[model samples]
Target: MTTVSVPSQSRLLNRELSSVEFYARVLELAEDDGLPLLERVKFAAIFAQFLDEFFMIRVAGLLELDEADLGVRSADGLTPAQALGAIRERIGQLLTRQAKLWKRGLRPALSDAGLDVATLEECSDKEREKLAKYFEREIFPILTPLAVGPGQPFPYVSGLSMSLGVIASDPASDEERFARVKVPEGLDRFVPVGKRLVPLEAVISHFLPMLFTGMEITERALFRVTRDADFEVSDDADDLLEAVESELRRRRFGDVVRLELSSSASQAMHARLVDGLGVKANQVYEVEGLLDQADLSQLVAHHRPELKHEQWAPVVPPRWARVKTAGGVFDEIRRGDLLVHQPYQSYRASFEAFAQAASRDPDVIAIKTTVYRTSDESALVSSLIECAEEGKQSVCLVELKARFDERRNIEWSRAMEQAGVHVVHGFPDLKIHAKMTLVVRREADGLRRYVHIGTGNYNASTARLYEDMGLFTADEEIAADVADLFNYVTGFGRPQQFRKLLVAPFTMRDRLVEEIRRVADAAAEGRHARIRLKLNALVDPTVIDELYAASAAGVPIEIQARSICMLRPGVKKLSETIRVTSIVGRFLEHSRVYWFESGDESCVFLGSADLMPRNLDRRIE
Candidate 1:
């Protein structure tokens, strides 16, 4: 057998396509009948929602790159236009499988299980009357029909908002009008009629005539528009927060990257949408079944718990669980370093309980933490607020740049500020993404710092659904490093260096590469060398090159990348010693863990950062 090393770029895979493949993995779960019904339904919804975001951000950016002729290329060397073509082709194929999963599989299964998702045609006359009354009372007041004619410009289609393209004609005036009706976002995607659920768009389409008063509906089709929602704040903007909010306001009208139409859409309606939305034919997608299969989430829940996965309550390890209740979370950490594998272990018992105890502990002097994506009623945030109310010094580094979470973070920042907690919005140019907390407590010997570092957000809601890692340690070196990290984020100067932690945009990438090279050296020396990485994405070209170097040196490397893996593993000598796997299941795998070994010594690091260039070089993690 002959072995050859492929160039780094040659070994790279298209990031966008890899991301779609991740969604396809989710769809596989949805298509598999062995899983619980609602769990499969959940995956189906997640698959659609994932693709929606992929288009809104990734595909939209590519389309813009193509339009601007910037010649932007991905790690795999595909130009923007070329990537768009590949994406369109891939999504078209995925959509077919997705539609079949719903119409041919889940829909029938749900009907057999005594839950029906009925179309307008399937509704009985009595059911129709009931829905009509319900619509008039609950939905009619919010409906707005915009007519397009000589003076009427096509109504602005907001991104991801479902709507109806209506063709209505006035018999008396012989006037045919093209109109659009936006489905109310506040209402459920599927309305209840007896035991059956009806698509909201279908119901809206059924009553288009009443909305137009004198006009008769000739044809109607459900449609959705996805627009570019990605924006960057000016580094030197007078007010970064204001700039971000302004950009969010403008995001609604961003260039339409995709226009999805129901298969029932007439050629005339489709043509009108494409023109009005300024979307190209390649960007228009005709959906065979529901325009937004993500809405299936609303239709899938059943009264029978058997239809859903068996509820599993997170539990603390018996070792820590007893110690936590007996002495405290601090006592448990003081025993040694502790790891909380979330969902498997209760976030409430570990992270939340830790914060709550710190806030209430009279011996605790000060507390500092980072907030990226937290809930409105987060126990963690509330604990900080309580700590502040108790006149304890508390600081919060809230990253206002967390995508899709800017508004919520902004609101939380303001509330924390009002509560007298020292709130920092972090840098305008760099988002502080490290999930860490520092608690300074009065120990008998001296002031000892306790720290908690995690691979997921501090959001309690997601903790139950996202598989993450949290480490509680009283290690002085690591605690000092965390304190320095907070100082860098909140105060003037960065630490010359971190003693134990790998902070990003400064030392994380360099340290990671150095560690990888050390493993490669060990392999060359005929010593044991190995590496294991688990992250949401692995696309940094430099890091991939390093891994390739290590693999060629015979260093065994295994990676569990949940999405967007660029490195092509098991490729002859180029990556013969490296293996990559993506695990997609009931829970989202979001933790980032990196391990390296040389001879007998092993180094392990877990953090909020992934191996992507943005995370390692641009963001502050």
Candidate 2:
């Protein structure tokens, strides 16, 4: 018998292209007429924000790649520059589809539904008069018209900020001039003016003559700039927070990677804006209809409940519903293990209640947790503050490098520190991505540690929009493992072996691979074997190779990924037993669950780390 080997490149898909495909799915939701009107609008706004982050980080990284690295190719064999070109081409198609949807589908449908994003030309005479008065009194005072002159340099257009590029001509001197007027961030992007929602930019554009009073405002082009927002802090930095703060400051002046403009802009104005920004020609994206999809969020916020998805109220998990004692929640967890699913089960009743209970419990001597991401109104932050105030030791491992959430995490970390909690921003390079809480209580027996671990961030707002699972347990071995993990993060103590739990950057990847191989062995023996995975991404080459091998050995694999799956399923021989699907809908499928069966019993993992190299190798899951 002859054996054939499939090349590694043939088994994988480009990760960057895979991500753009995810957004394409999101855009499809906006085109879904079966969806509630405002729900469609919400998806549209989300898609725009997704693209913003994609360019800010992913494309920005590609643009900044050094000459040597740019030549290196990805798993599917496209070099960095080639990937950027592919991303650009795909983005162009997405934007075209998005624009068509907005103009032919959403906008018209919204108008018929009485929730329209209107133009000044669409306003009635009486409504126009009122809006004009409103603009002058409300928006005009906030506007500042900056022009390029002998002493004045071109204005710095902040990233993602919508600004008007003016081609103003001086009538007296016959001199052609250029100026920029920044749309006020403080004002609403859209304003309600009698029966419709008006984009604030139109109002600003309507009154641009007022800002550049005497000069002839020849052309008013609306455009947005997306600059490089990705940053890194040195591991050697003594003060990680200070280092991050410095990087953030430097991030503001990062080279502009993308320029978005109205499709109707004049040629001269377009060239002038592009030249002033020093952005490459290929980087500019001319948008039709609304220039910024994010600005449509104001329209989605309108009081039209009938046009949106039915509101969901997370229910209290039956276990915590009847608890009345100050620390009764912890006692209930000890009674039996508790599992709460977010957006279905109440986050407030589960995690928030746990933190509150720990703060109130005189028995709880200490509270330790990791903060990869959280909300401004984070219950854990307040709970930790309260616990610290009550003389309980409160230690928080705040990850200050959670991508776009860095600034907010920094703010939360500083707040925790001020409240006397031991706030430890994890290492600059090695991010602490695990989401778990360790509560030490002075019980009658001795020191009992209660653990709350989850497959999502400890954020209240996202809890309602993201699907996640969290476990509240007093299981001795798991509790001990979590405690050890916390110690390893804050101080130093790496256990040689973990009895039950799998801690990442150490045990997770190897353990998961071992489970896969075990199941493959069972399948090869003609026994029952299967693998099921639900995650945000799966790009780790090592794990992917193992999966392919398992599938070849007759093990059945089912993968449901939300974004960026490198694994190409349904291959004739290499992965005949593997299946892949992506689920994107009202709720973001944020939880990660990897279940493997050998014969009868199954091994399952639930955590924050995705099957990606960086998550497995650098992050502490």
Candidate 3:
């Protein structure tokens, strides 16, 4: 519970700071002594990746606003500059904690468990000799060392790649010079010289003379770059695929947002990097131990079952096997709305089987779906290609601007287009984030459509790792609504009004706000009312204000967000009747559920839209 005077209160929390707190929770998992050894190790790796993304995208965004002097502020009363300062200080604390957790807790515990992560000095003479042979044969040939001098301006350093920034003296001239040797990304992050594992960077630093044969190495320090990778395509671009490919190329050389420098680095060395990379003082970080903890995933090679979480195999329901029949999926759905949960209920057995059956069924006349993110070797895309080959009407809206997944989505779009699938390569300003599929079959009585609306992507691999839900239904109104949505996406102009489905940038937000008001009114009239929400994020100011109003009216609100919630619950007079829980750990909670109840009336909704502003006002849901 939190209490604040009316003059000092800000009803909403900072989204970026809330995200940092979420990552801090992830770090807590890494520091947890109760979890399995490798499980904690996995969280450590996840924390690294999370921090990388925060710098690459979130921090980079704030720097853009700050540089432009736009002064973008949220309800949390923090401008972009203020948020960056808070983020930097808090993350510094987290990084300090992270380094200690790995060096003091995890590494030592793993060694005790017989899975040693040894340093160069810990290795025996025999192991050193073996490592020397392996490094020369497997790693040396792949290495490229670039010297920075008069003509060779600073070499272009890619984001997230670690490199050794070296200042060496030419013996003849006794003049110091700079050079960079990027640790080979192709090689494994950790190398196995003997029984123990060693960081590949350590081995590279150990044998620096092989590249600069005659130079005397004076100062050497490891550093990594986090570049501003976020990009937006102009709405006026003529060719989306070409534009997206160009953006991908530009993203490779984005501005350096964060610089991870070795704490042992000299002030002069730091200045060389600061000037060379064009990074400011605040953007540079000094960290001890590992620069990229994500590489700790290499511990999976230890093969100690007792040290890791037990492997899980998803169980498929027997009834889902009815997809063997040509119209089996439709038959199953026609009976009733079939709800599916992943990692608990097999995704391949249900969704993939539905697509496969739809591809092969001769009675099926059309298939439409949206692909925001999918597996590299996607069975769903394969089925769509086969359907198009069979001369059926097949349409796929592949979002090419899916952040880091742009290249993959671009490749998928080209493949689908080549296979005669009517492909829509996303819009310029908006991303179609809804996960749904529509299948129209030519039954004995005219035509009927079957639809699958989901809270997750059509990704088979992520299905085993993320907990998500979807409904396969043949409901007439819902199917028609989905059909109309596809027409709006694949066709020209605006979409026709939806009869049942709540489409974002249209009716979803309005409908949700209306329901919240209804619940508040019921509570104000002394009737029992309640609101429950389970989502990944909640940050839209309007919805949060509505929730606060409902809470003040005596309506109870409970929210379970898997990550990044801006609502501050249990504040007196403001949100005294509200509670929120962030569900993290194990599988990621991916499903979104909205339930509002007032006395005898009740309503429920599920979709990909979080209460975030982008989802409610900009993107399609």
Collision count for each candidate, in order: 0, 0, 0
Q: TM per model? A: 0.97, 0.97, 0.97
lDDT tens digits, residue span 1-621, model 3: 122234323677889989999999999989999999998998999999999998989999999989999766757888888999999999999999998997899989988987778888899999888888888998899888888888989999999999999888889999878999999998888877666888888888888888888899998899999999998899899998899899999999999999999999999999999999999999999999888998888785567888877877777767786556868878888888988888889998889988988899999998999999999756899999999999999999999888899999988888899999999976787889999999999988889999999999999889988989989999999999998888888778888888888899899999999999999999988898999999999998789888888988889999998789888899888889999998888888999989999989999988788998899888989
Over 4 Å off, model 1: 1-9, 300-302, 324-327
All candidates' lDDT scores? Answer: 0.88, 0.89, 0.89
> Candidate 2 on 50-70: residue-level lDDT in tens?
999999988988877733574
C-alpha RMSD in Å of predicted model 2 compared with the true structure:
1.8
Clashing pairs in 3: none
RMSD of 1: 2.0
Tell me the spans in candidate 3 whose CA falls farther than 4 Å from its real position.
Answer: 1-9, 301-303, 321-324
* Candidate 3 lDDT: 0.89
Give the lDDT ranking, best first.
Answer: 2, 3, 1
Clash tally for model 2: 0
